[model samples]
Target: MNYRSSELLEKAKYYCNELSKHHILSKYWYELALVLKGSTARGNSDQYSDIDLVFFCDKNILDRIVKDYYDEGLISREDGIFLPLPEWIGHYNLESYDDLIGYFKEKNYPQIWEYTNIIILHDELNRFSGIVEEYNNYVFQDMITDIKEKYLSLQLTLDWLRHPLKRGDELSVILHCSKIIRLICQLSYLIDEKTYPHDKWLFYYLKQTEFGNRNENKIKELGKNIINNSIPLQVDKELDEYSQYVLAESIITDLKNQIQLKYGNEPWLDEWYSFV
Candidate 1:
């Protein structure tokens, strides 16, 4: 963690502790989970980074707590983001996840994805931890129980690879390789049941997953070769785009087989009709 992140974390911890001690919340304190999220939780904080906190608890309790936070000026203003808090500032969002589950009876991927990237400062009731592990075994279709759409995407993108390589179309070859690699990367996160944060961090954190860790070197090599295709169309006599086809082919092939071996391939076939 960088200096600003470390310092922000400390201040956040203190603020939460204070909130717990206040007369308004002391009794219900244990029920609350003070979740540190966003850029700070990702440990890439700068002075300008706004600290976001998620409050997970019962609706009544959360309502009370949010009102208190606002009254103390401990919560932020809607006017604009607080500039680098050289001093203590309140958490910007009174984000509540469980309260959503209570109202809606389910959680969505966007919510799940946010919860996945968190620094849980406090979860005395032990609710947030269980929610985090809601993802397991295989990725859900939009976090639904039955969806194998990710693999279908992987297979389709994989199929496109052969044509470009056969035709020796340099641009098409590069485009297909890029898409295949991205699909594989997406599937890696789905298999591991983690959120693909979808930015520079997409690949950075992919290597942290069970699938990505095991195939780290291969993924890195493939990524490097594909990305080395220079922009503005530099022709390299030395480089052959077909070289990547074998590597990508191997990756998708292995992933496809393993997923079928473990989960069986019926979900996509059964549910795909609805999609079409």
Candidate 2:
């Protein structure tokens, strides 16, 4: 962690002590409070950042804590406000693992792992670790595959849009590119669910996840180039028309190789390419 991050965590510690002074939710002083998102941010100073703290506790204690904080007007949309997890989601039952799982499943949420895999604060025994582990094992594979399939389909669509006859088709291709970028960020969060910088998390997480691969440098270049140069095109410009096709082609090709290594190829690999 950087110096700014360390200082932010220290500030969070001070916040916890302040809460303990209230006595209304003092029982949670002993609760686990693991900090996250030290490296997955863009800002250089603590003045621009909010320290993320995930506190795991009993349901009753959590309820009392939320009530006390809200009563104190600590939770708000403005900066430096302390938001209880339930208020952030606009739902209140997160203390129950079953309820949280069911809610995410029902919403078809992509960041289930994020909400479930909170960093514990004070519990030395690491009781909440198993919650994250269970979802990673059971939910991760399907989410990865779903994202892969969506990218593949978008690739085929973009490839088709490359034909001269499909002038207006480029608009749809751009929409699909937006979806692909959003999905990539969401999947990367599941792959690296430690924290949230909101904007910078996806880029940092993707880079970290791809760091050990031989193709990491190439993948980084492609992603950065697409975002920097290709994303701001006008609807009818030639740059906008061709950029999606090429960008989608590059992303699909790189992801195919990665997926093949991670998930292996099937007998119908060539046929699947044609189908895509």
Candidate 3:
């Protein structure tokens, strides 16, 4: 690992240790911390940026433990149910390795690995590894195959929106643009080991990825125009259609190349978007 990764690992280790002190999670359940999205690849993980954590436990025992902690005042509740552990804590969830991976696969949950540093507790390491292996063999392999198809379908969507007839309607453009952003965001996590940020940081982190570049500027311009227009035009005739086309094409091409490189072409590639 480079210096930044090494530092990140250490910080993650420190966090695990602190959680252990609180009896929230210990080194035994600590699996590994993963880097998701952002400039972490650029070595820019700082205090303002939160590090996401996935705390795995035996499904049967996990809920009991969390409940016990809350009852004892060792933890506090947010939103009446969600436990707010500490300031630095980003995402916290409990799942047995088996069910958790299944949920991940089913939901197309991105960033479960990215910027995630898991600390598997000692006794459960074997269980954790076994589940991961099973997922790799079954769920993950299928997921890789799905990634390519989704990318191809995504490209088709962008291609359709690029047609002259479809290009002029601002509402239509916004709809297609939103779909493209979502596809790229989801696909980025699927391939590059990325994750969508928590709701609080979603837009900011989106702007930090390739998907952001494709849609953020236009979304911002449209947003401002909408706010300023007393009666918003059904379509913004003033918007730069040519620039939008170029941006959309670049994003589609980048996504296609990334999909091919990460997941070889699969015959079922286009079918994957049915889930979308």
Best-matching candidate per lDDT:
1
Which candidate would rank higher by lDDT, 1 or 2? 1
Instruction: Please give, for residues 28-97, the per-residue lDDT of candidate 3 as tens digits.
Output: 3344222223333335566554444455555545666666667878668522223433664443444455
lDDT of 2 by residue, 1-276 (tens): 567756755665665556556465465565533334333122243545555554555566566667666677766422122444322411111253454445345433434534543334344444456555554445444555555554456455545555431444444554555555554444443433222224444554455454213344554554454433343434454644555456655655565565556557743333555545
Candidate 2 clashes between residue pairs 3 or more apart in a chain or in different chains: 32-121, 32-122, 32-123, 33-121, 33-122, 34-120, 34-121
lDDT value, residue 214 of candidate 3: 61
Q: What do the candidate models score in CA lDDT, each in turn?
A: 0.63, 0.47, 0.52
State every prediction's TM-score relative to the real structure: 0.57, 0.59, 0.53
Question: Which window of 10 residues has the lowest lDDT sum in candidate 2?
Answer: 85-94
List model 1 lDDT by residue over 143-219, tens digit each. Answer: 32322666666566656656655655667867877777776776777666555665546677777666777777887
Q: Which stretches of candidate 1 lie over 4 Å from their true place?
A: 1-8, 17-33, 38-51, 56-91, 98-113, 121-147, 160-179, 192-200, 227-241, 264-276
> Compared to the true structure, candidate 2 yields what TM-score?
0.59
Ranking of all candidate structures by their TM-score, best first: 2, 1, 3
Ranking by lDDT: 1, 3, 2
Lowest lDDT 10-residue stretch of candidate 3:
32-41
Error of 2 at 88 (Å): 16
Residue 226 of model 1 has an lDDT of 61
